[model samples]
Target chain A: MDNIAGHKSGLSWVTNISVVVLVVLWLIPTVGLFVSSFRERDQISVSGWWQAPFSVELTYRTRGDGEVRPVDGGYVMEGNIFDTGEVRSSFEGGASTVSAFGDRGVAPAEYPAGTVAEIGDGETLQVNADGTYIYTSVEEPGNRGPRVYFEAETPPQFTLDNYRNVLTADGMDRAFINTLTVTIPATVIPILIAAFAAYALAWMDFPGRGLLIALVVGLLVVPLQLALVPMLNLHQRLGIGQSFLGIWLAHTGFGLPLAVYLLRNYMVGLPRDIIESAKVDGATDFQLFVKIILPLSFPALAAFAIFQFLWTWNDLLVAKVFLPSDDASKVMTVKIADDLLGSRGGDWGILATAAFVSIAVPLVVFFTMQRFLVRGLLAGSVK
Target chain B: MAPRAGFVSLKGFYMPVIVQGLLTIVIGVGGCIGYFYLSNLLLDKVIFPAKGENAGRNINRANQIRPWLFLFPAIFALGLYLVYPVVGSFWRSLYGRSPSDWVGFDNYVQLAASNEFQQAFFNNLLWVIVVPAMATFLGLLVAQLTDKLSWGNIAKSLIFMPMAISFVGASLIWKFVYANDADIGLINAIRASLGFGNPIDVMQIPFWNNFFLMVILIWIQTGFAMVILSAALRGIPEETIEAAILDGANPWQLFFRIKVPQIMGTIVVVWTTITILVLKVFDIVYTMTGGNFGTEILPSYMMDFMFRDDGRATAVAFIIMIVVLPVMIWNIVQARKEMR
Candidate 1:
């Protein structure tokens, strides 16, 4: 193909640049969120995540409260402003330095660090880059020590505290367990049920097999939104309302159309001679399905498994409607949408960490099993 | 209960859920396999023994009944979960909140008059039209651009990565990008750097915010469109392309004139698939804006009436189904044609 258009050197460069632009445009948003999840709370609020690797300068105010003693014909107070608990907690990483100092909040950075400035009544104040300050006056200092304001430049910092906080106190750990509890059975049960049905449709001489296949195709596009109210009513009547069992059954029912459709499509493509040979060897239909067809349909089965697993795990609407709303039963998607988005909407650190935690498993599954996923998509849709 | 309690005490709160999940998987898979195995065993051994007296007729009878045996569980689940619900939703939509209170067409009448429902319907129309077109176009573009590149596979994987992320997570990620604060929002930060005076709330801009929401779906679905269309592009016969090049077709003409026509069927499939998804999109609107500032789609709008007004919720559901029917029939007809 490339040889067909050999003189198009200019077009090749355009193709390379265009792909680079497209890939970056797609990857930036997720990368931004991923970087923000590790940053300190104040840092995330004050600056964009792109500046995460550089030091951030912040203004802080602390009081000089060292002992007032006689020195140089006056009274003096000496202490490191960085040693104060307020300033120490305000800076995240190790070894911050004062860039500038002042006595008033409005003019916090009036004097550069390591410089002295004269105040009224013959008093002079000096603050250094190491955060040590000298305050001297002809009269003794007041009971409430002089207020010292300075600008500090702190090193770049990243921590696991956001992840720790959300996992423990935010109940994401419980929601994670609940998601697995819903997803595994929902994913597994559908494959088994759909496989048997697909085998019967593909190999057996059934009365309405054609119509049944058509019905599955139509049902594939039917919105599950229609099932929410009626399904809930049915669950209540069956006495399984708002429980894990109820949600699992709902997911299984909803997942079946694609399951049957994909698996049956794949099964219909199997070589006829293989099945015929197995039949000649005295293999019953059940034995043929269990022993021959099921083993041979491994790629399709893996494909559908990944689909159902990702769908059930990432689903919020179904879980919200079917599962119990209690804290203990909430899945990760629901917990993030209802609780985190509601209360911690502005807390990017917690929000980013929670979203990442919920997204991590599916991403790993996707990357590892992407080949099968792509194959399944082509089979399921392209025909 | 004793085991659950001991596990909870030993491993803290999440242990019981894990144990229960394991138990469910074991019992569920084990039960399904047990049923299939036992039902067939019973048919062959007891009722239709393949030995002695009536062996030939008995085996014929068992063969006639065997397909139904294989299909029973799936049929039962599908009927209960999907088939029954579609009918039940329409039936329930005829009444008010309770079964005894009959109000025929009243729910539909109210929904027709409601401003929010009208807005949501229109917004859904916008989504259906815009999301599929944009996603399919971008996907086709990428698929074509990366078709002959050396690192095309890696490029395709990165573009496809968002498909794994849940709608809620994607919404949060985009929310950070569209944040109202100049210092935090990526868009606003860029604006601020380019000499903009004040930051604007991107989600609140009246009619255009819908496009903002649609971008998230486009970002997520383009990869799907890309993966499928990329395969379709590869499947185009090489001889046809060679002939087109020999006929002096320029690169632009080579694509639109030759390649796209060949893969038109696949492009339609990708378009309709995305259209169906856009019709049911709820989590993005629900999580990002909660249907505020004129971004309500039908699914999110229906959620507002859920539990509060069951009648109206079902009515909305039926409307969505009605909108979906034409596409549904087209898919079935195409599938039937392919089978022949």
Candidate 2:
């Protein structure tokens, strides 16, 4: 078409630029979180993630409390500012160079490092680039000593401690295991049940098959919200309420419509003559399904498996409503949404690391099996 | 539980949760396979034995019963899980807080009178209108723009990457983007650079804040729309495009006049699919604002009453079902038409 068309070549630059813009726009949000997860907590609070690679200048207030000595015509207090307990505790990284210093908090960076500044009350302050400072006053200093305000340039710092903290202390490790527990059986059981039902709908000569298929399609859009209260009631009555078993069953039910619909659509398109020939060769229905249809339908099965895996893994509502809220059984999405969002809302480092931890598995599954996922999406939705 | 704990101490490498998870998978899958195989074997060998003077009749009977054998577990699960809930929700909605107390339409009356319900209902309306339209339009635009590019597949995958992220995770990601601190929030940082003095809390901006929440969903779903609609675009017959080109249609005309009209069905499919998702969106609003500052939608509002008032919760659930009913019917109709 492009060879026959003249304007398309002339407009090719427009298409390329537009796509570049779209891709960048789509990639920014997730990239923001991913980058934030690696930064130190103080760095995340003090600077934007986009500025993470550059050095940051921060001001700190500390008092020189070292023993005062009587010098010629003055009293002097000398110490390394970076070695003070306040600076060591407040600063993030190991090595920091003093950029500027001042005697008053109002003008914290009034004089550059390696210079001496004179005060009106016969006092002088000097802070070198090595973080060593000297304070000389004509009058004897009080026990509090002179207050020194200095700005320092700290190098870019990143750590894996955020990941460690959430995984161990915040119960995300437990949540990760619990999510796997909920997702595995929930993803597997539906495939088995839906496969058999789909085989029956596709190959068997049964009454009400058309109506059944239509029923499945109608049930496809039934909001899972309709199931919550009633299902919880039923689960309590049946003595399976708020357990892994209960949530598994709930996910299986909620997932069935799409499983059956996608599988049935794919099965109905199988080579009819092959099925007929197998039947003519005296194969029983069960044998025929296990031996022939199931094997030939691997692509469709793989597609549905990927869909159910991603859906169940990324699910929050079903897990929240059906599973026990105890720490022992909390899934990742529930943990992140409830615990992290509530208490650690301002802790971007922990929040970002936890979110990434929960998102990592599904993303791996999605990229590795994206071909099957795409095929499943097309077959499931587009008629 | 004690034995599992003891075993955990005995074998220091094994976590009890991981052990339980592995056991569940094996048992759940094994149980399903065993049930299917045993039930089918029983139907063939015991109830309708195939080797006798009545072999033909028995075989025919078994064949008639075999389909049900394959479908029984699925039917039981579907009926128990889905079909029973719809009816049970309506029944529960008719009663008051106590199940035995009959309070017909009282919950609905109170819901109608409540200001929060009205606000949530209106917010949901805004979501239904805005989210699907923006996501679909952006998706279609990306699909069209990237179609002719050499690296189109990579571009599509990147756009679609958000589909893998859970809504809770996406909300957290967007929270950082919309943080109130100018140093941390991307939007506020840009604003500060432009000389805005104070950092505004975007989520507390009343009605307009709803659009900010909707942007997170649009960001996540645009890839889904792109994937589905891109396939639809490729499925278009090339003859129609070439004929329009020969007819001297400009690029915009070729797209709007020649291409879009052909894939309108698919566009509607993508639109309605996203609309249904928008209706059920809960995690974003719940995690981001907890439905505070007038960002309540239906699902999160129902969650508020879930434990405290069963009747009210079911009432909200029933309303959501009612809202979804038309789309459900439309989906079935489209599916039936395709079957024909």
Cα RMSD of all models vs. native, in order, equals 2.5, 2.9
Whole-model lDDT per candidate:
0.90, 0.87
What lDDT, from 0 to 1, does candidate 2 have?
0.87
TM-score of chain A, every prediction, order shown: 0.93, 0.91
Best by lDDT: 1
Off by over 4 Å in 1: A72-74, A89-94, A102-125, A137-139, A142-144, B1-12
Task: Find the candidate with the highest DockQ and give its number.
Answer: 1
Candidate 1, residues B1-340, lDDT tens digits: the string is 2122123333356766677778878887899899999999999999898888899999998888889899999899988888888899999899998866889999999989999999999999999999999999999999999999999999999999999999999999998899998767999999999999899999999999999999999999999999999999999999998998888778898899999999999999999999999988799999989999999999999899888888889999999999999999999999889878
In candidate 2, what are the lDDT values of residues B1-340, reduced to their tens digit?
A: 2122223333224366566667767777798789889998998899999998999999999989898988988889998888988999999999999899899999999999999999999999999999999999999998898888899999999999999999999999998789999878889999999999999999999899999999999999999999998998999998989898888888889899988998899899899999999888799999999999999999999999988889999999999989989988888887778878
Candidate 1 residue pairs in clash (backbone atoms < 3 Å): none
How far in Å is the alpha carbon of A273 misplaced in model 2?
2.2
User: Against the hidden true structure, what lDDT does model 1 obtain?
Assistant: 0.90
For candidate 2, the chain B TM-score comes to 0.95
Per-candidate TM-scores read 0.96, 0.94
